[model samples]
Target: MYDEIFETVVQITHHDYAGCIDKKGWDHPAYFREQIATRQLNDQSFEALMQDYLRDYQELHMGFRRLEQESQRDVGFTVRRYEDSLYVTSSQQEKRIQVGDRIVALDGETIEQAAKRHARELKASHHEREDWSGVLLDTSEVEVIASSGGGRTLALQAFTKLPHTPSYKIESVEDTLILTMTDFWNHDAITELIRHNEGRFQNAKKLIIDVRTNKGGSDLAYSELLPYLFKGSHVDLRDFGDKAYTLCTERNVDLRVELMDQVLQTIEDEKTRHQIDVMVRELKKNRGNGFVELDLSEIEDNMSFDTKQGPEEVVVLSDVFCGSSGDSFVETVKHSDKVTVIGRPTLGMNDYANVAMMTMEEKFQFWYPTSKSSAVDEGNGMGGVGIQPDVYIPWTPEHLDKDVDLERSMEVLENFTHKGSNI
Candidate 1:
């Protein structure tokens, strides 16, 4: 099973035109074979080994999965690398651990040691992370400056914030509207949400669009949002850039066809269905013909949804969690004269997309990108550093309870003169 997994990934890595192309970090077939051969390998151990093998890539999109085990044991929150130090990013309320608190050590492992070992990958299984039981956490002691905990100790309960449930709402805060969406896959749901609440939006002068927890979904989901964001005097071209290149292989084509078949059957919208149909047709036409360029934008959906004229100013809130189509959303809205993204950088997985999956005898699966965007060579790649915010707000503990980003957005809209005021 291990050998098979390695070979499958190796084949895709060599053929797929993405970041791992020509990278020989994980090429020691015999070395890995010997290492795993000597170890008492289990599911978790194999996963760790594979993780280390692919650690060099550290890509948010490139990873492996299996019959979804609860791998992450939540000790109230997850820690992430901010500069050279590790800070608490997300925490459950009961834990009383503030977001942005600096942790000096976990399970006796110092921050420097853990950082060296894990690099950028901080998973539940790591030695520093909490187990099914728990681990000792030593927080930094400072003069209450931002994230210093002043040396505290507590046994945080094991919890799971995994398997995120989608949340969506449009709240009317006097004149300003707060649109918080955690999803983008349900087609024109956002469009419908806006249209249904048209009167509310029309009256509002400043709009705060929050996607801090929104991981992302289909691009079509935000189709209705384009017009509201457009600040240009002319039309919103919404150029998707040059054509994306997909490695034309039999397996790649077959997987795409299988995936698109579901799209054809599930999506009721005729135009969307047609566009997907066209993609699949193109896949079949160019299978095993080396790398081929796919221009899906050529076949237009021609959505005639009425662009809302209200919301003179728009502030988009994003986080590091926002990625894939989420990154696409941030990029797409940049063309809008009224849109100003304010938050942390995104997850940075937009360079290679249209993820396809391959299952190995239902035991495990390898999901990877099928195509590489022209943006890679065009100096617009989003593999490492994702879309940057117009107004950057560093993550702090005050944001644990309060929506600091939103407050900042409000501040920007009320006092700070923005370029969009004239638009």
Candidate 2:
């Protein structure tokens, strides 16, 4: 009877995998083969099976190769400094070249066409290697806008301050200090700024940490900064979800036991108390037996700020690029009373990812999740709906060019500050 059902289901479903229809038939491959053979498979069915198998095999192979490339790719970029003249280096290769002498073009056009033409001829002749070959051209418009040394310097400075540019100057308004971090991981300069202001937090009437352009980085660094803002509060900084198993810990057990004790003592109804007690005992048994300890003690100690403060006011600035550790930071901050998040919605990834190491013969590589992460809720996978802000502020091209978001944040802070004033 089971064999007939299995064959019927397979035929209807168009599945081609081989398996026994019953436990007794597992050892008899001939019987199993005969059962499958009873139903004659057509060309279309055979082709479908072959295509499905090939597709799955190819996908598995491609997945491994992608992981390999990600682990091996160079994660570094060139850094150029402008001294008396611009100097650029391909940091990985340690190749250095002077800009003015080599790069004779602004855009596609030449700064000195005759010099560039002659340089091209020399380059073609192989007098110098291509690694050191091309002239270093200024990508900015300042080169043309200011022909002289002083004018060029001023224009370059202004260009650096341009809103759309990669870097910007941080400014303070009233009690609010506006800092926009556009890159992943805090650099030495940013670290120093945080350190310098650590002691001054008490003086701040309100604090705003802006990361609208923050791409993301080390989760440890991002989350470690939270305690400082809170001062002191026994806040749960992390939560984990397991679908198949209930996670347990001494701390979780104690928490459950304490809650149960309270419920048993507080509820006057005998039947309800008895029912609650039984439920608690069953839950405790299941969790106590299965609980796995997660090492969050490290994070607890690493938090620089005291946890005594119940709540403080903080506003997190976010955008689509805020991900990974950035997502963790935003979620962690949302728990505090003092923290009121403002800006556009986040990318809504709340869980962490693991970077796995792989090897292909002699070459070693690693694979990381391009879009794989679990949230506190196991079902809330990566790319889930992101966190929405209390106040929604959209980005516009004009705002990008003029720092409109920063201005809006200031307005919010000003209104908040003035609302408390008796005047």
Candidate 3:
């Protein structure tokens, strides 16, 4: 049993480490087997072994961190990076924490002080700080300075302060429709957002999508929005090595393609069905080779605008906090003339996607990015290098008093009107 477990772990790691693994680091399957051949298989020992393996692939969602003894409580809010500080934007109602609160300290140490102290353990990016804030919230109480110039303490609890509503918000800003999506985890929410805002989206001359703090979730959620945005035929590509697998079930190697099986079965039009059939067949033709082309125009789903008429001018707000599926969304749309990305560079975490979850025993589980993606830029593979914005606007602390990024976006749109995008 021990050898079997060790072999399985090695097999999964070798095939699913997102990027290539260094043999000198821990790539030797035989060496790993020998190292743990004598240890008794328990939660503690297995977790310790897993930790050593995780240190090498520190990319976002590259590995799962499951502490057998640590409490899983969280503060009711999530935060994002602005300048060099972390600020709360959404929270659960049970906690006193509110949106626009800046996290100053955790466990009694100032954030800057903590970052410096833990520098060796953390990555050299603002996204690391944002993630570390969430990690801290999992275990300790935090100190925050609210936008109203007051201070308070927030502690972790079973419930979070973030509202359990739709992940997106649609509102009018002059002639533009401002759509702020906090995440893409809820497919139902995405559908509701599109259905609810179909009329409003058509009336607006332009649209602004704010995904600054979105860390990502399901691709199915954001892909539902692509049909409305892209005008012409486009192809998106993904790779899953020679083979792909999800820990959840024994489906085909590619889960994204597998999701289409249900949709294909429901289509009644033979012509539409044939077009989709070709796309799906092409997507799955060479599953083992790792690269597959997806035709955007072929996919027929009900999650789009009836007119198929998108905004004349589009703006996307991004930051280093936009990671995972958020990275995928930005990378996919960056090339279109209909959209312009603004603000800081997004968090690069989508190069390796299609996370396969695996549970070890009953206490530990592992989530690995089994599929490699070339959607944003072919061969570039957005691992550490994320999507860059067309218009660069750095966030300043004073912007907490004034919405600088939004104002800049509005100005850019107005300039496009008068200057015809020359400015």
Model 2 lDDT at residue 73: 26
Candidate 1 residue lDDT tens string, 297-368: 557544333355678888899877788888888877765667889988776677777777777757667777
Residue-level lDDT of model 3, residues 1-423, one tens digit each, is 445655666565655454543223544455556657766666545555654555555556655444443433455566665654577755654357667778877788876777776653455565433456335543467777878898878775654223334357888867888989888866666766786777776666788999987868755566546655654554333311212222222222455455556556654545445655665575565555443333344454422322256776788999887888798788767756678899888888866666656655555566666545544235555555578888988665655567788988898888877877624
Q: What's the lDDT for all of these models?
A: 0.66, 0.41, 0.62
TM-score of 1: 0.82
Of candidates 3 and 1, the better by lDDT: 1
- Number of the top candidate by lDDT? 1
lDDT of 1 at 76: 57
Write the residue-wise lDDT of candidate 2 on 263-332 in tens digits: 4664454434454466456546655443223333333433334463221355678765566566656766
Q: Cα miss at 83, model 1 (Å)?
A: 7.4
Candidate with more favorable, higher TM-score: 1 or 2: 1
- All models, RMSD in angstroms: 5.1, 19.1, 6.4
Top TM-score hit = 1
Candidate 1 Cα errors over 4 Å, as ranges: 20-30, 69-76, 80-90, 93-102, 120-161, 232-242, 263-266, 302-308, 416-423
